[model samples]
Target: MPESTPFHDLAAFIALPRVSSLALSPDGTRLVTAVQELSSDRTRFIGALWEVDPSGERPARRLTRSGRGESAPGFLPDGTLLFLSSRPAADPGEGADDKQEAALWSLPAEGGEASQLLVRAGGIDGYATATAAARIALAAGLLPGAADAEQDERLREARRKAKVSAILHESVPVRYWDHDLGPAVPHVFGVPDAGAEPSVMVDCGARRIGGSGHIAVSPDGSLIAYTAALGTLPDEIRDAVVVVDAATGKQLRVLEAPDAEFGAAAFTPDSRHLVCVRERRITWDSPGDVTLWLADATDDQDPGRDLLPAFEQWPGAPVVSPVPGEDGTPVVWFTADEGGHAPVFRLSTGSGDIVRLTTSGAYSDVVASPDGATLYALRSAVDSPPAPVRLDAAASGQEPVTLPSPGQPAALPGSLTEVHTTAEDGTALRAWLVLPQDARPDTPAPLLLWVHGGPQTSWNAWHWRWSPWVAAAAGYAVLLPDPALSTGYGQHMHERGWAHWGGASYQDVLALTDAALRRDDLDGERTAMMGGSYGGYMANWIATHTDRFKAIVTHASLWNMYSFAQVTDFPAYWMRRQGDPLENTERYERESPHLRAANITTPMLVIHGDKDYRVPIGEGLALWNDLARFEVPAKFLYFPDEGHWITKPNNIRLWYATVLGFLAHHVLGEQWQRPDLV
Candidate 1:
């Protein structure tokens, strides 16, 4: 009962005041959110640094007191805000532990107190790139959270270098839910004035510091762009889009992002174009569902130029330029769902004309009032929490500004009933199906086709996860399909695997598991399938291509794209995003079901973490050592401390109590200890 609210499909319009990052205060009159309360474990999230309302009779204002884990809010240069944290001292015991990460703070928007400024590792100053122009803040460190923890045998060899691939590991799933635990590096730094006392510039290890966000100045602020993940690794992640010189921090240009790779980014309004969502197939069951590239460069030495002439649907929780209408045109909006409810469209790149403003099945996010001419959009669903409707495109329609959900949910129930279906190629696919308030839509229940993991990351209409509200209070119905590369359905059904990755996304998830076994209360021999990284490689390639899922779990998996293209710590980004594995050797060996591990019989479990360097628990211990050397029926739950998705609430209640005893023993035969969790 963490205040109940779970369905989580992620079209992002989060409630309880979950704004997830917003900016534009440079004299637009006021609008700074980063407000938080994710309710239950991204590590107990607590953020607050809001401030909207400008005398409208009060709406937002909590400026700061988070005790730990916030993220890049950055507003400084006198409007004062800037964020990025993981710091929290003074009381400590919900402490839990995982090493933590996030430090770099600031506060003051007509508020008070908040200042630590930068602590990467404390001093050899080895960080390399950081940005934020005009008021200057640049970093290029070497000693900020720098490794080698004062020799306790080098801190147990830096904790076995947070293992994960020492032959199939599963660590990263530690817990505490916020209030600062300690050390977890995605390794960041974008200093120019991260609130002041900064220096150095550009070297996020050649190109990888821009997740969430990191410095981008430009609109007449003198070229700064800043957002990295710089490549040259196991296959090249190249999280780049750089273009510095914010007063000689140098490294003027380096864009690289071939077909589409960044996953979630923004920096447009004359920053000389830099949109970034190019996320090519990420997993944990879908986020690979975004594609909004623009990346530019006219003088910083040239290289990043996509400009998205076409294809950009679930551009991963997007929000850019939103309030500009009247013949001046800068709109370019994008909230997703174009048709199954979660609206807010705009586009108009000088007459591209996408429009669709706001339709309503709840969940919206347009946002804009720093004086761009009012545009809060916002809807938020799954029981309604984020209200705010205001709009104004220069006046034509809109008015619902209710506001007041600062993390709302004093109690909720009733409203998450949409469920649309269709997919033998009829396409229309977006399911919601949350049932189980004690089950009985005529009682055939006990189904779970639930798949999503970048399959190209697409699932809008705010459902926000709480383990599906305890799997609908342990009764279950779930469904959740947005198939066909999924992302609010547009952009050629999200590149339907552009070069093919198991034909038509594995027969559109085996035709939606035969349309939830003809849904008449759903129990088709107790079906089950799960996902994590690319929906854990489509639940271990649907257990080596179909046994009709009696159970299979898979998280952070790759099984073995030829040893994940050879030991992945990002193996050159899965060999340039699944291509050239030696010119695609027969399509990566008939769709790499871990090279067809003798065909997998099902009854599987395998969730991972051992610090998942990004899907690297040696692909969940190579499908648990080929399902226990071909005995089939497997189960391997590791965590050691966690990483890629399993954000700790007692390890997400031990990953949904081991998928509720593996879907209560393959769909209700019950009797589970491990008969694959069932």
Candidate 2:
């Protein structure tokens, strides 16, 4: 029997299995994905590997399962499945112990128990497999001064024995989004085959890999390419794609530009070219841009060619087709944010031609069939969670077929529709509105304007962190707008709010919210606003600028701009856009929400995580203090062990409960019922 609560219940919703990534076999006969579900203890989510039929004829089957679980599934050329897991080895002599980290494991194609293939001191961060050869490129971290894996292991053991947990940093960025970066530096390793000993391919040394841990192996297994951080200064530190000889560990070429950062390298089938994403460094005068770059693997002096030179939307990392196009030219498949959807696009390298392959949904973890006739990816939209889907690689404006997935949720409590409007400056503004099933003109639902985080991001994809459906389940209409600085729209949309956080972006948000309120199913009088990170920043901005919202919830938000610029985890990145607080105080003085805190009359709920280095806990603490000083009706929801995102399952439940209760008390005129656990 189905659960009584259904997906509308927070408990049942959190327990639903989630499928994340996909890995296709070299021969296109098998497809594998990683599914994360609630553990038996119900404290955390555990990931396990699952096999989905490539033909979509059979039900998805579980391939590997353990308390520690497995993730990052990939297949060797011989059809052997490999993954990373902290699970213990079946044999006692295989060296699986309590101190074991995530190591590489392989399951044979003939079928049997999986065996440990490789182990490292710091564990394997991620790995890449060659499509045409039996070669694997793995990324692992090594302690300072450790010559080899054995020494690294010994050094780790020594630290464990001494009970020391300190990291000495000499670079500008000592910490990342949530974790501190130091003690060990990531390096690339090459394994000729499953049995072969791994050899160093690219030693990252002191320069930490800043971008995604992108590592790709050439089809012939002779070369490896990865993103390597360059420069020592804080502002100068940018990522560059580095190609090296797989066997000798010799640096073949470094693809770098003075004004641009390059990473996410994908080698073509012929191994003569590489496709990567080039990010233009942000400056005070202009916003950053990204495009698909095709770099020559053999020529060191050749600057890469831009495939999407005129393309407005930012393209994701390129996925080189296993087989060339019909014209015999290499074709690259990639997804880009386009008009509220992340669609897969086919790019012909030789002809510089691009075509959209998917008509809807945000796609990720895309992989191509060996024959290049079909593509597979995990697709998700505002009303759905990520699920495996199959698409035609060459077709234009085609809808993908959904494959059987474990992550599919039950029927949503409401429906999703679009809200369109024009900003004050005549710019187009759009939002997604979720209306409850019972909402009607006579009994309209309360409105909740949920702003998205990444000021650089869009509200196009499904986000587990902020599911509008949760609010819809409570008979509330949620509006998710793609304001200025949001992707998927043209570059002009981002530039419209560049450095002027309170100008166009704020107006665009209000414009869409106004359009949403005009609907008959929404109640404008009983409305609230909430956001996290940049969205949190917006909530604060909205509260100070207008008394429209009955209640405002801000999480991990920036209150004092001057303080946040100096204390954020990556100071240089934000400083590039806001400029130095000491010299450039125009945007800071005009836009800092804390400056206008006294204008905030709306009841507010401040939520923040102690480990949130992005916005820092100080922002929330300061905002709470300001609300108290102003004698504004307010509450503070603090998470001591959480980061920018609430990852702990129980804490997530409490988060939703607290926010809902707060909204109910303020917007729905319900009695304040504090969550029991809180």
Error of 2 at 330 (Å): 1.4
lDDT of 2 by residue, 1-678 (tens): 222334468887788888899999888988999999999888999999999997888999999989899999999989999999988777644344674588999999877899999877788888998888887888888898888888888998899889999988777677778877878988888777778764433343233767886899999988888888888888898898888887767788889987899999999889988999999999997889999898898689899788988888999988998888778878999989888889999998778888988888899999998888899999999887899999888889898888986877678888899999998778888888888888899988899999999899888888777988888888889999999999999999989999699889999989898898888888889999999999999999999999989999999999999999999988988888888897889888998999998999999999999999888999999999999999999999999999999998899888999999999999999999989788
**In candidate 2, how many Å is residue 461 off?**
1.4
Best candidate (score: lDDT): 2
Clashing pairs in 2: none
TM-score of each: 0.29, 0.97
lDDT, candidate 1, 1-678, per-residue tens: 323334331112232346554544555556655666554444455666565663346766666665564654656546666666666533323531233545455566676677655544322112221123434333333322344223222433455577622222122122221111123323223344443343353223322333534554554445555556554332444455566655554566665544445534455555555555555544322334444555454354444433345645553445566344455645556666544445665565555566655546454445565545656655665445454445654342344555543655434322245455566657765566666654544666676666667665554445444334456556666666666666566766756654566667667766666765665666676667777777778788878878876887787777777776655554444455566666667557777887788888888888888876656677788689888998997778888677667664445555777777777877677787642222
lDDT of each: 0.55, 0.87
Predicted structure with the largest TM-score when compared to the true one = 2
The lDDT of model 2 is 0.87
